[model samples]
Target: MEQIQRSNWKFNMILLGMVLLLIVSIIYSITLGSADISMKDVYQILFAKITGNNALLEGFEKGWIDIVWLIRLPRILLAVFAGIALSLSGAVMQAIVNNPLADPYILGISSGASLGATLAILLGVGISFGPNYVGISAFIGALSVSFLVLLFGSSSSRADVSRLLLVGIALSSLCSAISSIIVFAANNRNGMMTLNFWLLGSLSAANWQIVKILAPIVIVISIFFCFQSRILNLMLVGDEAAVTLGQENHIYRIVYIILAAILIGFIVYACGIIGFVGLVVPHIARLLVGVNHKRMIPITILFGGLFLLWADILSRMIIKGVEIPIGVIVSIVGAPFFLYLVIQNSGERRQ
Candidate 1:
């Protein structure tokens, strides 16, 4: 809350601490999974593999190298970026609509993306697109549906908060219903099982190929968003107020929506619908850093990465042997937190 008045040195120190903490957490997290691997061994394996020095890999078990280099690291990295992407998107979107409750779920983007992926998995919707076509299918569906939402909300070229939200809800219902119809009609038990597990979300399938693709896009978009602090702040004031400040909220809202759409598309493509990370993280960040995007975005991004990284770790060990789906873990935590946010927001409105 004191971010605006906090000294740059203090803020910078905190930021550096969070960065270092995320690094330390990543190292620690990699060592704790089913396989018995030490932090020292984790470091040696990373150094050897990353440096392409086979000689350094001499004494270690081949299975340990496979686990560290191929399995755990990419999964952890996916969780980090997915967390960052959702949190950043949620922050910007809450600003765009000037609504604290706005997120991928509320805006229907997740359902739309889910519908796309369902089609890809069941019906081979984007098979022609080659490798990772499912992700491509999801990207197309999210972008297309969000554009329609914007178009409907922006009747006569002006998008309003209420219109956007209402249309989003309607599309969410429609998309979910359509996806259900497809699943039932397909009547493929194995595919149904696949879809159910996928909808629940897991990082089990994470690989270096996905990490190589998703990490760069997320980082690039995150950097772009930091530079947009000014525009994001303007968005909170509503179009009428923003007009007086000589900013056209319509165009900016459209641009922000498209960016958010693209961001959510790729996220759903990577991790499935890990719901409530978006809804919960930004509000927590706002409480810590206040409403200033400049003050809040970096903290939001880091906090998000940390939250999901730990959540993934919890998902692994929560059960005696079998891992819990990461999405279920988040929903168990997030649903009640959302109720709290609603109550808090209402209490403020009453005052």
Candidate 2:
């Protein structure tokens, strides 16, 4: 009992530490950019906005107000929510499919979104949402593909993890091939280049509108996933074991898949396709808290946000004036970091 209590206490401390770190990281990220804003000014701007105090803003130039409030804060907040959505979804996906190598995109969400965005860009085909209709199209494509994948996977009484994975892979390849065809047939070099960049992912389009649309959904879904830790843990134990315990996993698996699909769809729409956060952040979270979903879910959420926060900072500042796509930054860093974690874990096992 004492040991159990000690473990609980330890996890609590770590979770609290992560929450503090994430808050600090978000604030720090907002202060970065070519504009040379200080932490003090950022805070003051935020305080003024939050409190509706015009007096607090009198000392700052109008340009500073626009830079801080209109640009940086929304971008940073978007990064936070985007990170949370991918990482939390990744953790849930790995558990649902019972594959350590699984990621949110492994289920064809990325390819579907890519196809949708490609069509919107190349053929001028999409639902009219705004200036950036590509993202909406991507959202539609991602959800459509996920629905098909689920239909195939659940054709049996229960969704077989292996079968579901195969189905996702197949559909993903089909989407990618179709997207490639569209790109090939379109002779517009500029549109193709734009499509290429969008696929690499970026937060350059971040704004108050996108953040407002994304934040509440990510928050609500994350909270829902946190409460499903019990079923998620049971997932890692395989179907027969869960059935023996009187829990039917098919319904749970289907529901989880649909919700995860919705979450990833929104994330892809918000930022083109920030890839690695979903694949590796959950593993890193597992290292910190072990495999218990109760603990892993929260850590994954914070770590995802923290990881992307730093990645976005690096993305913008890495080149003096030119900003690299955030997806490029994530892949470059995440590949090495994930490899290091794998090596270290393997070495420890050897001991």
Candidate 3:
């Protein structure tokens, strides 16, 4: 009874922390943008909008209102959902593969999506899909490559994690070659420019319409994965042990991969191919709370959301009045941090 009560208390505390972070992040995201809006006006506008109480509203600037309410808010929400989806997928991937380095983009999903988007832009394929045809094409490509990787990776008598990694790398290289060919062949200025920006990733395109589409996909997936901590724990124990315990890791492996692929595809489509969130967030979560999935999953998602929120903010404000690609920001920071973690871990192991 004591243990159960303790667990409940811990869970409640974590939930409270998450709620506080969300509220604080929303406020910060709303108040700080390219166009400055005072916190007072920000709260008044939000309060009046929510409660229909215009008593506090008096001659506020419309431009700031539009920037905060219409533009920056949606982008921040998208970043939150994207962060959650990527980190959840990353944590689950690490469990499924039983590898510390496993991430959502490890299995060629980003490359495939990038190839699809490149094709759509350079070759004008899938133009009939509407305004966001590139995103649609990219998602289809990601899902397709993911399915192929599973099929090839599972072709052996035993589902080996090494086989999956090798197959994923090969497929990723193939997609990259194809994308390069298209870019070179097209030789069009606008197509190349569009492809470059898309590859680097951005949340500048966020809107309510995008939120409506991506929210359910990401939120539902993240919630479902949280309940899967038990299965994930078993997966970390190796396949032989899992079989002895009468738990089929292969089936769970495929399911996790498919779900991760879908979430990753949507992210790639929505924000281009932002890298390292999956790799970095899960490692940080593991370091903080050990390898236990119950604690790791939620913490990873929350940390990932916060990390990307700040990354997005910096991407916008790093060079006054100029937006930097988020991918570049993540790569710059993640590379050094990853190196430091490797050295520190190696030293500790030697010690």
Listing every candidate in turn, what is its Cα RMSD in Å to the true structure after a full C-alpha superposition? 2.2, 3.2, 3.0
Model 3 quality (TM-score) = 0.87
User: Where does candidate 3 stray beyond 4 Å?
Assistant: 1-15, 51-58, 124-133, 151-155, 340-351
lDDT of 2 by residue, 201-278 (tens): 888878899898888889989999889989999999988899999888878877886777777777776787777688
lDDT tens digits by residue: candidate 3, 1-351: 998898768766875687688768767877776666678888778777678776656687777667766787789999988888888887887787776655656667778888888888788889999987977888778878877776787644555666777887899889978887788788877766766766788898888888888899887888888898889999999888988999988788778877887787778877888877888988988776668788888888888888888889889888998999998998898778767766876788799
| C-alpha lDDT of residue 40 in model 1 | 92
Clashing pairs in 2: none
Off by over 4 Å in 1: 1-10, 152-163
lDDT of 1 by residue, 269-313 (tens): 888778888889889887776788897899889988998999999
Query: Candidate 2 vs candidate 3: which has greater lDDT?
Result: 2
Worst lDDT 10-window in candidate 1: 1-10
Model 2 spans > 4 angstroms off: 124-136, 147-170, 336-351
Question: Global CA lDDT of candidate 1, please?
Answer: 0.84
* Model 3 poorest 10 in a row by lDDT: 153-162
| Model 2 lDDT at residue 5 | 97
- TM-scores vs. true structure, each candidate: 0.93, 0.88, 0.87
Model 2 C-alpha lDDT versus the unseen true structure: 0.82
